[model samples]
Target: MSALETVRIREAGATLAAEAARFSGYGWMRGTSGNLSLVLDRDPLVLAVTASGLDKSELTDTDIVLIDGDGVSIDGDDPRPPSAEAGLHAHIAARTGAGAVFHVHAFDAVIAGHRWPGGIELRDMEMLKGIGHSAHDETVWIPVIENDQDMTVEADHFDRVYVPATAEVPEVPVLIVANHGMYAWGADAAEARRHLEIAEWLVRFTVATR
Candidate 1:
């Protein structure tokens, strides 16, 4: 890779590390249970994924690995392997055109998924605006898919439930994996974090109410 590309990868790693730390502080990514990825290239689909088995709160800029569309490590120099969920991150990016994907094992996400196996529906809430919905009279459905250990199988399940945005329906940027956690994505790192936070908040509210 050229010097510029190398610099970009390093920058992406730092961004992921900081984001991971933020989530870890909330106990959502405790004990290396979550992963984050940033899309570096779109055509061939290259990503900078957080390295496997590292404490999210302690990661440095070097604690990341480059992976391809198939989650195969492309950075030979980096001894660390990509996170086990890297393939799922790649799949989400490919399907949604998202530039960043974040997975977190938030407790409320698990509870909400378990309570609403079909999906979680929230309407007419001011918080709904955070996920890009109208604050009034707009109903948002957060789909929940069954959790699977195999990344490929999980990706397939996500595909089955994903609905693209239309004039009548806005795009849902987050989804919960039943008995697992949640995945949120956006056009970039900051937006992805926002989506994840908002989704968690919504789920927490739902769980508390019902």
Candidate 2:
């Protein structure tokens, strides 16, 4: 990698680290459970993913590892391992053209997923507009898939449920892994964070009022 490219990635890592830390402060990513990733370059498919088992509350640029499209760590001499969900991130990016992806282990997400294993359908909520629906009558469905210990198995399940954004899918930015957590993505880091924040909040509100 060129020196300039390395600098750019480090900068992006610093910014993403801060975002992850803020989510951790919100009790969403307590400990080292959740993972965050940003696509650094598309042609070469370089991504900066959170290092495995690193406390999100204390995330730093160095806690990010550079990986290739295949989710293999390509960061030279960086002993840190990429997040176990790295492959999942790659799949989302490839399928959705997302520049960033976030996975969070939040209480509301787990609760909602269990309560609505078929899927969580939010309707008549003002926040529905924030998720891209044009009107109040529209319903937003967040699919809940069963979680698996094997990342490959989880990815396969996600592929089955995840339909690429078409008229039917309506650009749904988040999904839940039953009793596990939520996955959100967007065109970039900020958008991904916004989607995640909005999705999680919507679930919390739904669960509280029920």
Candidate 3:
């Protein structure tokens, strides 16, 4: 990558760190159970991924490790290990061409996923537009897949369930890991944030109304 591109990626990572801190403040990332990542390059396939076991409330650019397509840390002398869920992030980035991915352990997502093992169908809400729905009446079906402790197994389950976006299928960029949390992605960090926030809100709304 060019020097300019590298600089831009660093700046973007810093911005994402701030967003992580905000999410932490909201208790979405409590217990250090959440992670976020951004794509830095496609040709060589570099990513800025969060390190494992770090407090998001104190997240900084240093907390974001640069990794390759295979989730190998490329950032020199960065002692921290990449998040264990880094494989999932790489899979999503490769399959969906998403520029950013956010996985959070929020109460609403966990509760909703448990309540509806099938999925959550959010419709007739203005927040749907935030997740790429053009009309409020359009349904946003977010899948809730069973969770697994083994990363390889979790990834295989994800691969088996995830359907690539197409003209015929409405993009389902957000999913819940049953009894776990939510994974939301978009073209960039900002868009991913919108999707995550909207999905969380809708999940909470659904649970509250029920």
Candidate 4:
């Protein structure tokens, strides 16, 4: 890689570390239970993903690995392997054209998924606007897929339920894995984080009230 590309990767790593720390503080990414990725290049789909088995809150900017669209590590110098969920991240980005993907084991997400295995529908709430839905008189369904230990199988399940955004409907940038966690994404890191937070809040509210 060229010097500029190397610099970009390092920058993305720092961003990922900061995001991880923030989510960890929220108690959504406790232990090494979550992962985040940033798309570095779109054509061939290069990503900077958090390294596996590291404490999210304690991660440094260097605690990241480069991976391809297939989630295969490209940075040979980095001894760490990508997060086990990196392939799911890659699949989400590839399918949705998202620039950043975040997976967190939020308690509410797990509860919501288990309670509504088919999906969770949120409507008539002002917070719904936060996830690109109308604040009132509109509904959004957060997709949920069964969990699998094999990443490839998980990716396949994701593909089966994936929905393309349309002019009439905004894309729901979040997904929940039954009894597992949530995945959220956006065109960039900030938006991805926003989507995750808003989705979690919506789910929490749903779980609390009903």
**What is model 3's C-alpha RMSD?**
2.1
Per-prediction TM-score, please? 0.97, 0.94, 0.90, 0.97
Colliding pairs, model 2: none
Compose the digit string of candidate 1's lDDT tens values, residues 1-210: 899987998899999999999999999999888999999999999999999998999999888898999888997777888899899999999999999999999999999999999999998889888888888987889999999889999999999999988897779999999999999999999999999999899889989998
TM-score, cand. 2: 0.94
* TM-score of candidate 4 against the unseen true structure: 0.97
lDDT of 1 at 202: 88
lDDT of 4 by residue, 1-210 (tens): 899987887899899999999999999999988999999989899899999999999888788898999899987777888999889999899999999999999999999999999999999999988889999888789999999988899999998888888999998999999999999999999999999999999999999999
Which residue pairs in candidate 4 collide? Answer: none
What is the Å distance of residue 95 in model 1 from its true position?
A: 0.6
- Over the stretch 1-210, how does candidate 3's per-residue lDDT look in tens digits? 688966876786697788799789889998577999999888888888888998887887667777787777887778889888887888788878999989999898999989999888777887777777755656668888899876667777777768776685558788899988899999998888888998888889999998
**Residue pairs that clash (backbone atoms under 3 angstroms), model 3:** none
Off by over 4 Å in 4: none
Q: After superposition, how far is residue 140 of candidate 4 from its true place, in Å?
A: 1.1
Candidates 2 and 3, the one with greater TM-score: 2
